[model samples]
Target chain A: MGQEMSKIEEAKNLTQNQILEELEEQLRVEEIEEQPDTIKTEEMVINFGPQHPSAHGVFRALFHVNGEIVTKIEPMIGYLHRCFEKIAENRTYAQFVPFTDRMDYVSSMHNNWAYVLTVEKLAGIQVPERAEYIRVIVGELQRIASHLLFLSTAGLEAGAVTPLQYYFDERERILNLFEKVCGARLTYNYMKIGGVRADLPDGWLEETLSFVNRLKKTIVDYDRLLLGNYIFKKRMKGAGKISAETALAQGLTGPPLRSTGVAYDVRKSDPYSVYPRMDFEMVVRFQGDNYDRVVIRSEEIKQSLRIIEQAIEQIPDGPILAPGLPKDIRPPVGEAFGHIESSRGDLGYFIVSDGSLKPYRLKIQGPSFANLQGFPAMAEGSYFADVVLTLGTLDPVFGEVDR
Target chain B: MLTSGQLLEFANTNGIPIWVLDASIALLLSLAVFAICGLGVIVLVYMERKVAADFQLRWGPMHVGWRGTLQLIADAIKLISKEDIFPKNADPWIFRLAPTVMFLAAFVGLMVIPIGPKLVVQDLNIGLIYALAIPSIGVAGIIMAGFGSYNKYAMLGSMRSAAQMVSYEVPRALSIIGVVMIAGSAKLSAIVNAQSVWYVFLQPIGFVVFLVASLAEINRVPFDLPETESELVNGYHTEYSGMRFMFFLFAEYIAMMAASALTVVLFLGGWHGPGPAYLAPLWFLIKVFAVIYVMMWVRWTLPRFRIDQVMDLGWKVLLPLALLNILITGIIMLL
Candidate 1:
């Protein structure tokens, strides 16, 4: 082994002890050679991709893998760089909802609502009671759809093809509902500035209720298929574990954070959009591993159902959209960062208005971005397969992560 | 020319043309077995999807012909027309031959397998040994594809597979030995005949050990560490594209089916049915599909094991259990 090491070192033009030092020097040089001369690691970097299938979009993970477990990851951005924030800045408050559809295309309706809710909060706009209830129902349903995707994609990347279609079979129904409500399927820009774009389609409530009813049985089936699976347990349990403190320090929110035993849900901790009035338990689990992340999502889907059920019952007989909010009205020159508990994590919008028709600047605080910060920490010293599972459990949508 | 042992004189009395069987008849028989095995792979894949749907609470592949029964046929067509790309620097000969060798090795193993009463391709007296031996030929295909592709990841993958398959074979064969001893025949039909009661009930530990090791042998998860994507990037066939990739996939699914059938034959009883002997192969088919379904379920349900853990499972858990089964079986046979 020593002879082999020496031979490798000789090939690299270095001694055994000099190898680490030379590597560090190379890293420093690579960092300094950047366009702006920024310091960075140059440690045998491999570009995970701009068009790679596994990167899950035009996402690139610049990895410094010492063997299998990545030692450093400088995630390069600006691939699916659609300039969404810039587009949002120029569009009217109502027009901006469509652009929000571009944010996370998997659960576009939830992104639409998150943006609209932020704008509504800024303008002191009170949506009709029915709209609030309708919003929660749609949002929760979108949460299930989003997490289902996370679960399936995670499974697919991990070599589990059956679950992707199994989850997609149910997902197709939800997309059908979205298509019925709005003319679009993937990007439902249905949530307007003040409320929803229109009232729920006739029998939409009944259809949603039926879906909710079936989803209960479906969750049970998911548990039977996956929860008690010995392989699933072995793969996920104690893999990619993050302490509650580590999660909080990294600004991780939503299920990933909650899975670490921190019950800080935006719905429960800082309620918005009639969530305070809605009755639902804040689903949580203690072990901050990939298994816990998965289970938390499972529980959250059930909780989302509970909330949706209540929202359907409590929906008032009134207009879905408020009548008075102007289509182009802009807020005064001030900055407001509105954060919401999106299905992935804490999705937020930071708006800087110049007291004009359009805001001067807008920033999207995609939860997936912050959630990715926990990845390197979780991945270090883990097996190659576990890295895939960990990333899957983190549920980082490259759209949000790169945005 | 018949070598008879105690209670084996029936073979000489039957005067079967055990040697030099007609080439055309043998070819026809081999072709028939091949067809059955191919059909079994297709049906198993579809049934696996359906079972997965049942587990995941949804409908699966319902849009194709007649509740998606022809989905596999459609998939086969799609695979046929696909362009098979050879990598720029890949070894042309080996790359082209890899999938064929893999499929051939697995397919040939089917010949020795006893399907039903008097319905075997060639019931070699060394049928059990032949059944175990043919699959190890697949290791050459894996290594050839891995090295021939000249992809670093594929090389690593094939290397890991070479090590894993060889290591796991020890326990896999040992586990089956318990049943072979009890049956007292290397002939597959005789083994099936001996299973008046399934070895699964009598040799439960052996059954479990064999099942685990067989999964490792087929490179299914939690033993799918060789193809760990996050590590070696699609393992051995990373450079293989289009139809070549499909061929690799075909081999994998076929191997999954074949391994499951072998497990059924060895432990679950090959063709002993509740009804007539002619229905035995159907029973065997059902058992094999059930095993395949469980394999798929496991693939979706669990994560891949680390190479070290996989090695440990093969040596530490399975090997010991297999040895224990042998020891106990020996003691019981002595008593």
Candidate 2:
């Protein structure tokens, strides 16, 4: 046992690719061994989605179960794929901002910001001070919206209906605030290559401040209703536990990784936009269980509210769009990658420009796609009900995952 | 005042043949009971929707009839007019018969409940036990539905339903034994007559255990693992549709009513409210609906418990509490 522990510790120092190769080798060797002639009953294999209520989207998985205990899970994704990265290569840099909005539709502001930030880095365009503050405000507002959606759906998945409606009421207010700035509510194509689409509308700042103030009180009520619920805590506390080593090995980021005490948020670590100026702590919990994942998101919403409040107070007056930007953005031959702490995790965009109107190659590192890798590890050997809870806590939007 | 026995005697005095009168009276009695239960289901369905809407901050059933009073009737019409679909591989007979069996289980229990003085459909010598025993038959119906559907979700749901219902029955029955012991009879009417002090005050533990166990038996929220929508889609009724689906819905509401009625009879001093003797049935109904309102309140507020957590709660918490209540009741009776 001591030798096995030392071997595992040594293996942690290896790269992810090397670990995958070793895992494949181990599987090959195990497959060649003879099976013992032991009497066993047939395990039921259930296809749990593509059209399930609690599946979050068209995500599907084959769950192999012994009665109610899930022994193995094979996650099948790409149902909502629309060749997003392929389309990005054909469209010009400025034309692709709208496409980013469709990636993580719930947090479109963050998606737009991440994409534009990458293009800004590639083009060497400088964003004005005021535009940076607006970007920060909208990004944090989008985080609150996305995390509220996570809490609502997580509650719905757990069989509590009231929280969904209550939380949606608050989310509707946030969406209205978004609509006031941009013309759209869901897929806000508001973030430009160097700045935002427009400045804050008349009284928009006051409306946002009022909404943020109201949410502070409402979040306390939500904590009493959902986070403090005995049944919810009992169901989620120790279920779907993922160790910190397993999380880091799986390349998990954002709240799912932070819940395991990693504290590696892109906003905190990379310090993009005005995040370094704002005063807020990265929400982290030491338990990598479903309960911690949920609680961390709830706490993150509070922190997002704090960031939004500070950004609103500190926002300066300036041009919303970058000055002297050409209609067709043709950057010099280069590649650049920019990441943000999206509500799900580390949302990054890598753009390769070849001194043309269109990008040579564009890749999206969607957090949901990476975060989904940790699910089977957490779900195996748990009760069948906990599988749904684990999936809810992971909060993978199929649009982002399959993109 | 208008017992079926009195009506039979009046028919005999008029020189009617006994066999003809008996058949006619039995048919009429069954029809009356069915109408009451059917109407109760409609009201309960509307009430559940309105209550849920109220909790969720929405106006429920407003467009159908005066604040959605006729919404269920419209829904019933739509269900009856729809195409009846069955899974191709499903067992045809059991698939068709499951809903009927489920509905009849609750219907039979309803017949034995003493709504008023001389108001029961058939107050048997063992009315209390009959009401408790008959509803357990619904577990068989749930199993049949799951087995016949040929779908894994329905199969899992039915297995959960069977386990939850069976495990809860022990606590449910044991909890009520305190009432039976204190009343010195299993007949529901006699039990009601004996509740001068309202057994809830005397046997509070038993009342609470019975309430929790009955919620599990009826598959209400927090114990609604059998048809947990998030986990099992529609659970045992995944393959049922059209009028067949409506039957399962009817059975659920009917079972809820039966459980509430049983709660009223056992603990809440059935028909003993301050009113005219002729208004006893009204008092009984008031208490029954009150219990049902509380059940719906709980359903919307609480999230569901997992299968194992539900089992733990039933066997570990509620069962022991029920036994202790019975033991305490026996000791008091001896003193």
DockQ for all models = 0.33, 0.69
Residue runs of model 2 more than 4 Å from their true location after superposition? A1-40, B1-17
Best by lDDT: 2
> Can you write out model 1's per-residue Cα lDDT over A1-403, one digit (the tens) per residue?
9999988868777564587898899999877687554655454445666655566666566666554556666667677767788787777767777778877888787788778777776777788888888888888889999888877776666555666777787888888988888888888888887788778899999999999999889878766666556656766789899999999999887889999999888888888889988878998899899889988888888888899898888888998888876657777777777878899878888887787887778888898888888887887677655765777788777777765
lDDT of 2: 0.92
Candidate 1 TM-score, C-alpha based: 0.82
Error of 2 at B252 (Å): 0.3
In terms of TM-score, the best-performing candidate is 2
Runs in model 1 deviating more than 4 A are A1-54, A62-72, A155-166, B1-78, B115-125, B189-198, B225-233, B242-250, B253-261, B268-308
Clashes of each: 4, 1
Clash pairs detected, candidate 1: A27-A42, A31-A40, A231-B302, A232-B302
For model 1, residues B274-297, the per-residue Cα lDDT tens digits are 887668878987888788878887
Query: For model 2, how does the per-residue alpha-carbon lDDT over B75-191 read when each residue is reduced to its tens digit?
Result: 999999999998999999999999999999988888889889988888899998899999889989999999999999999999999999999999999999899888989999999
Global lDDT of each candidate: 0.80, 0.92
Q: What interface root-mean-square deviation (Å) does model 1 yield?
A: 3.6
